[model samples]
Structure formats: structure tokens, C-alpha cells
Target: MTIEITGSAQWEAWQAKVLPPVERVADGLWSIPVPIPDNPLRYVLVYALECREGLVLVDAGWDDDVSWQALTDGIRTIGAHITDVRAVLVTHHHPDHLGLAGRVREASGAWVALHTLDAAVARPGLSPEERSEDIRSHLELHGIPGDEARRTVDLLDVGRALQSPAPDVLLEDGEEIRLPGLELKTIWTPGHSPGHSCFYQPDRRLLFSGDHVLPRITPQIAVYSQTAGDPLADFLRSLERLETFEVDEVLPAHEYRFGRLDRRLADMTRHHIERLAELRAAARETPGRTAWELSARLAWSRPWESFDATSRRFAMAETIAHLVLLENRGELRRGADRPVRWYPAATI
Candidate 1:
């Protein structure tokens, strides 16, 4: 269950109290703080790129006065104003990524560009037909009750009401986007989200990795909908593909930006494999058990306890996804009851 924060003004209140003053981290890039209270993951990073055509913003942060101010001031630090922004590129549809998109567009008249797949999720103001029922089905298959599943879906509204206009440009995988002075290639990296794309600059050997690959933590991979294929498997394959690219430094959405891309990629790849092993061991001892039961066995951060329904749903979906991955790899197996999945260490 989500720990609901009561007060309509709380989101804005926390933003004003915690948003850090804007600072430029690179010649053409800036880091704007977006603070979230009652959660450990507290900040969002906004990258601003100035080109002859104008500015290209990667990831629109939270929709709030503080967040807007932080972004606007950060842009001004490089001698550019919000009105100078030419276009916005969304890494994904998550609230933190698309929050200020509308405001940015309104202020600068910038056209928004996002992957078509992710755009579907950011559209929450529509009727039931617009939303995917597959998300609910995925949760139910993992043994989450109807009421809990419904509540989780409802919490998606937390950010929906704040969504900006749909993308002015629909991005496709493998498309090369050239905005006057910038050359960015869209690399389709599913798993985190169906159509999540990472922007890569071949000449600079730089990667703008949204939530695809973080500096410190693993991006949550789960079955949110009747999403195509195995998400965890897709993620592993995506990591392998990323190693093929020559990324000298990665600019992630959270945490500090760093160099040595291969090592960081290796670290991320190893984490999931090791996690799969741990899940295998845990399930071996318990054998026939439900996904929910196994989820309780795993350790989560203390701060996660206060996360809302959307967060909890992500946690549970990720847990089930790992278990399913192991099962698919012959490391574990599911029984007739569906919920009764068993992990036999000997099988591995």
C-alpha cells in the first residue's frame, strides 16, 4: 500500500524547501535539483544543450515553481533563457522525466520529442481506452489482489495530472536526430520502459543515459504491461549492446556523472546476474512459494517503506521479474498453481 502524503500543497512545499540553487556542471550541460521528500531518491538532473538552432533539453524535471526556477536559472548561467530553448527530448515517461515539459514548451515554444512507446504511458488525462489494461494483468499474474492492483493504477495519477502536451516529434528506435548543431542517435533500450531510448553522440563518445543505466543503482525492470517479450532478458541484452558503444563518459539522470563507461556497464551487468543467483538461493530454501512471499524475503531500503503505491508496485513487479528470469533460464520452475514457483539449486 502507498503511504499517501496528505496536503495538496505538499509537493510544491517540498520542492521550494529542497531544490538546490542551479549550477552548470559542463560547458553546455547543467544539473538542476528536483527534491522529493519522504524518499531516498531525492534529485533529478536536467541537461541543457545549446546549439545554433537553439537549446535542446533532455528530460523535463518536476513541474513546480522551484523546479522551473532551477532549470531556468541553470540555463541562464550559460547565458541562455527558457525562451531560447528550441526543443525538448524525453528519456522516458516517468513523472520526474516529463514533469516540466509543458511548462518548458509554454515558456520557450520548444517542440517536445519522445519515443512513441513512452508517450503512451505519459498520457494519463485520457479515458480508460488510452491507458493499458496489460499493467493490471501483469500485476494480477504476480498474485497482487484486484483492490491493490487498482490502487496502484490509481497512484499513476500522481504525475499524470502534471503531464504536458504530447510529444511534438515522435522518435523511433535507431533514428538519428540532428537539431542544427547536435548529432544524437537514439538507441532503443527497452526493459526499464517499453520504448526507453538512450541518446549517444558518436563523435564525443558521450552517452545521455536516462534511467537506463544509473551511476550507482540498478534501474528497476519489471512487467508493467503485457509488454512484449521478457523485460529482464531484454535488459541484459541491452547492457551487452551498450558495451559495443564507445562511451567515454555517461551523463545519467541521477547521482554524479562519471567516466570509464565499460567498467560501469560491467558493474551494472554483474549486479543483475548476482541478484538472479541470490533469488535462486532464496527460492531453493523455500521452494514452492508465491512471488509476494519471495518479495518479503528480499531486503529493501528503509526509506522505501514510505513510498506510494506506484513505488510499491514497481518494487513488486521487479521482484517477480527477477524470479521469472531465473525460471526462464532453467534456474527455477513454476508449478500448476501459478503462485507456487520452485527453485531447485540442483537444476542450475
Candidate 2:
């Protein structure tokens, strides 16, 4: 069953499909709804934790003026200015999560902290050519034609990394946040991103599930230039780690706050199992077909042709992630060729 906090303004706003009002979740803790431009998720909930020195934020929203305004204005609700923010603990390197950390640092001299692995590639790389090559290579792996892939790469929004600057501090798993009046521990959950983390406040019994877990929509786990091997396996193992946590409520990066994380984790796992089964069937029916070809046979929220280049890129990456997982499980064999194809391991 989905867990909902009793009479939460966030829940009401979620139902209304609008931005939730700023709420003081617990003593010395506040949740701010900062807008994300043109995203269906609407807003990212930036949590401000009070300390003797000043306020420390869990995540910052997008770098747009509107998002910055919402973040600053939300901070004002708790009688603090943007300048009062002393530190920012980033959840991951996503534009929606770590975008404004630089601006926040400029305004408040706040130190930004990100996981070591994510910090390595979170900053904008030096060469666009390298990025284009990476995109071409990625597309080729999924059987996208060279000319078509080039055109698609030209249109894809690959500049997202520009908003995420490097962090001031590199975080490690199980490390305690030493800010006054709080006890937040970093839980390294590498799946959604190589260095995604969830903050656990043991004293308050709250878990800040940054994109690692959400109330509704499943977090996208896809293969990309920054992604390492078998992200699906990493994601499932991370879920198991989180299942051991004892918490009263889960404060996700997006969506409203909820409880019963165990159920959510189980449901996400089941969703992946069903998805993998569908992909397995598709592979069996069209053995030796490329991942790109098999992707059309799988289920998606919308029709395949309706997806634009960026959306299709995400879909293809997600499909590759699943295919790679199946291969790792010894259920499928990947062809050793450019524009790689998949075949059933049992038949091979």
C-alpha cells in the first residue's frame, strides 16, 4: 500500500497537480518546493536543516531564475535569507538536484558536498567533441544509423551537465555530517547515477531519499557515458541496503513525503522483473536483433514514434541497461560487433 502522511499539504498539492506549499516538516527542518522549468515533476523539494551556524540544504533546484526565486522565497518563509544557507549536501549530479549549488555558494558562501564518484564527472567536461563522440558511440551500440544518430545527437539536450559544477567536498558512504544540531549520514546508493546518495537523519527518523526512491514514478536507471557496468544490479543491491533502514517517513527529492519504504522498494523490484521478462520475450521472438530493434517491442508510457530525440535517447539507454543486465545474468549473449545485437544464451 502507498503511504501518505496524514493531511499533508504536499499530498493535496500532488493530487491537484500543482506546487506544494512550503512546510516545516519537523523542529528545525523545512521542505521547500522549488520549480523545475518544463518538467512534468514540476518542482524539487529542497530540504533546509537548521543548525547553530546557519541552515544547510539537502539539494538545490534547477538554475533558472524562477527556480532560484522559489528556493530563496521558500527560505524566507522560515525567517532565513538565501545568505543564511551555510552548506548544500547534493543528492546527485542531476540538473534538477545539483544545478543551483554554485549559485547558492555564491550567495551564501555555502560549501557544497557531493559523492566522490559523482563529483568526478558532475562538472562540465572540457570538450564538446568528446561528448559528441560519446553520444555517437552510445547510439551506435544500440544500432542507431551513423547519419541519423549524428542528427539526433545534434538535437539532444546534452548541455545538462553545464549546470552542475564540481562540489567543494567529496562525500563517502557512512560518513556523518558534522553540522551542529543534526545527525545526517550519507547512504551511497549508486544506480540512478553513479554516486546517488540518500541522507538519513537518525535522530529525527527521517530519510532524505534523493531520486534513489520516490513515492510514485520509478527512478530512471539507464546506461550513459558516465555509467559503469550493470547499473540494474547496483540499483537492486542499493534497494536492499535501504530496506534495512528504520525510518518513520521518506522525504524523496520529487513527489510528496511518504512512509513504508519497504513496500516501495519491493514494488520497484517487481516492476523491473516484469520489464525484464517483457524484454526477454522480445529478445526470444527476434533473436540476433539489435537492442534498438528490441526496444520497439517493449512497453513504454507513450508510443515509440511520439518520443523526441532526447526521450528516445533515454529510452534506448534504459533498454541497453536491461539488455546488459540480462547478459550479466547469463540469460542473453551479446554479439561482438558494432551496432551490437542480442541472442538467447540457452540457444547459443
Candidate 3:
């Protein structure tokens, strides 16, 4: 029988008005909720695992005065100082997870660790002009108009400014981290980003699933120039890999902790399957359409026109991901035109 995972009661209570309480999650382990501005998810749960040296943070919240103060105060509640942090294990290079890593390192002299793949692109050592040109070319390749693509490229400046310093330690898949009292093993579960990871503690039957397998929201697996080919396929395989693990509780970066890893994994997998089917149908119905047009045809949380530039960019990337998968599976074919179009593959 597949078990269902109802999330943490304490977290659900605070979802309405207040931040979740900081509590000891396990022996020498504490959960701290740090606020994120203007986001519905509200906060990122920064887990502090204690050791003989000090605390090691699983992920740092956004970098800003508000988030910094919240993280520091939450750590204080657990009887430790932020300066006492020894290392930071980043799950990915997303702003909410890695934004404060540099600030934390500056204060604590802690080593920030990331998978080698993420570390390479975390901060592309390029001049502003060069980076803008790269973004423009990439956006245009995805069928976005030049003017709109330039605007999108300009919007990305904020994200580039927020990137943390290069990682201090480069981690490998399945490599055991030699912390003082923890047996955390890195599981490289890419596709959310090329190097997204989940840390596992087999003895505790716990998994620190970054954005790989969230309880409520399915992590967006979009295809971008930097992203690996067929990201949705990679995401599906990664989900399948998690089904083999025996996990009692899932500690995610966002939302509340939950159990029943297998059930949640199945739900996430089925979601993509349905999405893929939708994309395939969209392609068949509107033959010779670009990913941009096909994406607007699909259902979204809100109307495509209502989306901001960043959201539109992500939506297009996600559309391209589905199209790439369908094309690879012989369900669709790519046209050889500028601003390339997609067509339903001829039945064999």
C-alpha cells in the first residue's frame, strides 16, 4: 500500500499569519524558518545540524537585511550564533537557497559547498556586456522577439547581482561528508537545475530533498541554454531513483516537512506525465507552432499575458522542455526555420 504524507501540524498552523516556530527536529538538529519577501511560500526552512565544532546549515535563505536578521535570530533561538556556523551545504544555485551563503561565509568564515556542475555556472566570470549578449542570443533562439528578449535580459541583472561567491568545497554524488557527528551523503538529483541535490542520512531515515520532491508543488523543470538536454526526462529518472530509498521524514527547503517519500515521488512523476501529454496534444492541435505560442495555449495558474517577464521566460523554457522530450520520443518534429517551429511527427 502506498502511504500518504500529511505535512507538519506546526507548519500548517503558521501558514496563515505567522512564521513557523523554530524547533529541534532531532538530536542536535534544529529547523529555522527564514522569511522571503513578496513570495507566497513565505519562508525557507534552514536546517542547522549541530556538531562538535558548531552548526552546519543545509541551505541559506535570501540575502537581505530582513532574511539575515531572521536567520541569525532563529539560530539564536537554538542556542547558537550565526558566526558559529562551520559549513553550508547548498542544495542548488537558486537565489532563495544560495543568496545568503556569501553573507554567512563573511560572518562565520564557513565553507560553502556545492556540486561541481553548479559551482561552475554559479557565477559565470563574464563582463556585464558579454553576459547581456549571451542572454539576448539565448532568448532569441527560443523564439522571443529581440526587444522583449532584451527586456528579459535586463531583468536578469538583479539575479546576477545576488549570486553568492564560488563554492569553497565541490561535492560529488554519493560522497559522504565527514562532519563531526553527521553522516550526510550527497545524492545528485539533477534536472531542477543541472546539479540539484538531496542529502540523505540513512541511519535517521531522513532526506533533505532540496526542490527535487516537494510535498505540494512540483519543482519546475525547464530547459535553458545552460540546462542539460531533456531536463524533464532527467527529472523523471531522478524521481524514480528516490523511490528506492526508505525515508521516514522529508526536510524540504520550502514548505513543511512530511513523510511517505514513495507516495510523494509517485505524485510528482504522474504530474509530469500528464503535463507531457498536454504539451503533445497542444503540438498536434496547433501544427507548426513555436514553443512560445504552444505554451500560451496550455493551462497555467494565470493567463499567459498576466505573467511578468521572468515568469514568461520560465514558462517558455518549460514549454521547450516538453517539446524536446516529445521530439526525442518521435511524437514531434522540429522545423528548420529561424525561430524554429514544432510539428507533430508523422505516424509510422
Candidate 4:
């Protein structure tokens, strides 16, 4: 059978400007588009699954008054109310996916569920200074200069406002959610984030991929101080995991739903392989360089100098992920320095 990308045409048309209309995707599934402020991706698709008791939302859109209103309005269109939402299943702690979760719980007394690892990050207890310090330390370790690292921390602080409420239920990998009327199993795909999860309904052959897989763009996978292991490796493995599923359709958080899971997975895998080779070649040319410097030399969607603080930080992290992978594979080595440097295993 020829695999195909399937989703509401209207939703695909309004990529980043106007919000797409709330769409009934499946028998009990509804797709609601909520806008993300100043983001090129435009909006998140909050999937609401109807149940015996009320409704269970796969992910909540960004936390803001506009998003809140949009969510409520979208719910109303489905003959339901925000208060009818019984649970919010957060894919990860990213603001766009988990932002309004706390607010939803406040209004509806809904239980918010997240993977234990991400729950730690989303839980609200850290002081602003503490968060800032963590960010600063992580960036500095990745070879970012002190001042620039501090500035990046400040930029990241803006996202703190969108942190979701503490998770009421911590989900585990391969665990089936006990929703009254649905059978959704969590797949732990930890690359985009330590505990990023995708929900699969085996009966329906539907996968609710939250940034783990997107229809168009390859989800950003980067290394951070908080990251447990080689994120690039984890990302590649997660892509392979998709092949095990006989998915008829995919419902992603950012982009329109699509079929051909195997094809997209191959594309994502090839992307990283090419990125790894590029980094390896760059390492050969510049014998001993920090990830930060190497990142500046790599090709990005935009010029390195044109990137804002957050974008630069993400790019640096991505470079580091690739570097670490290369080092682990014996293609590169890390030098002993305060801000560690990477060198080709075989000197040019």
C-alpha cells in the first residue's frame, strides 16, 4: 500500500498565521489548534478524546489568555466544555505542549499526567534564580562564554511562566492509560526531551506523536546538562521504534497528521546520519574546536550570527549532541579543558 500524509487540508493551509478550525479527526477524537506566540510553527494540535466520564486531552496548548480562550471555544464546538476535560496527558514539559495544563486543571479539576522524568522539570518549586543558575551552568559547560550563557539563561526564563502544574499521575513506558472509553498506550521516546512520549491506540492504529515525529520538520534533538545520555543516539533509536508500529495515521502536536510512518522515520534518521557526517568532517578540518565554534561553522536554516539567544543555544546543544555521538563512535575525541573541546580521532 502506498503511504500518504493525511490531515485536514484547511489545517495544513494555515500553517503559521491564522488558527485552524477545531476538527473532528476520528470517531471520538477532535483536533483543536491553539496558537503559540511569536513561534514559526504557529500552533499546537490539542487532541481531545471523548470518554465515558468526560474528555481526555492529549496535550494542552501554550499557556496564555488567548490560548485558553481558543481551547475553551474549541471544546465548545465539540459539544463539550473545558470543564468537561477530565485529564491532560502531557507529552513533555515543553511550554507549547504543557503550558496550559495547569490552568486546565484549575478550571476542570483535571488530573495532569506526564512521564516521571519530565514531571520533575514541570513541577513548580524552583526559584527563578535557581532555574537561571541551572541554565547558566549547563550552557557554560557546553563551551558557551559566561556572559552569553547568562544572557541565554535570561531568554529561557521567559518559558518558566508556562511551566505546567505538578503532575498528578506519572506515566511509565508501555503502560496503557486506564481511560474509561479509550485504549491508549504510552511509548517512551526520549530524544526531544528525556521523557517525551507518544500515545498509540493499537485498536485504531493511530499514534499521537508529540514532537517525537513531525510531518515536515525534523524535531530538534539536542544535548543539555540535564540530558541523561547521548540524545542523538536516543533520537535515532526512537525513530527506529516507529517502524514497529503499524500506524494508519499520525497526529502530531505541531504539524498536520500524516501516514507513511516508515518513510518519515527514514527521512529523520537520514537527516541525523548526514548531520553526524557533516560534524565529523568539520571536526577533521578544525582539529580542536568547541561545540559552540563548530556550530557557527555549520549550516543552519538562518545564518549563525542572525540567530537569537534561544536559537543559538539550541543550535549549540544540537552541535554538542552530534559531537558526543561522533566521539562515542570513535570518530572524535574530547580534549581536557575547562570548556571541553572536540578533536578528530584521526588527526588530519
lDDT-based ranking, best first? 2, 4, 3, 1
Predicted candidate 1 versus true structure: per-residue lDDT over 212-320, tens digit per residue: 8876678989865545567899888888889889887787776656676677778888888887777887888887767766776776764555756776777777877
Best by lDDT: 2
Best by TM-score: 2
lDDT of 4 by residue, 1-348 (tens): 233768856445655457777889989899998888888888899999999999999999888899889999999999999999999999998988988998999999999999998887566476677667877887887678999998888776544642556789999999889878878999999889888999999999999999999888889899876676788888899888889989999999986888989888988888898988888888888877888889999988879989988899989989998988888898899888767888887763
Please identify model 4 stretches exceeding 4 Å from their true place: 1-3, 124-126, 158-163, 346-348
Per-residue lDDT over 257-340 for candidate 2, one digit per residue giving the tens place of the 0 to 100 score: 988888898889999999999999899988999877887778899999898777877888898899889999999998888778
Off by over 4 Å in 3: 1-10, 158-162
For every model shown, the clashing-pair count is: 0, 0, 0, 0
**TM agreement with the true structure for every prediction:** 0.81, 0.96, 0.93, 0.94
Off by over 4 Å in 1: 1-21, 36-39, 124-141, 145-164, 301-312, 335-348
Every candidate's CA RMSD? 7.0, 1.5, 2.1, 2.2
What's the lDDT of the predicted structure labeled candidate 4? 0.86
Candidate 2 wrongly placed segments (more than 4 Å): 5-7
lDDT of candidate 3 over 169-200, digit per residue (tens):
99889989878787799999988888888999
Arrange candidates by TM-score, highest first: which order?
2, 4, 3, 1
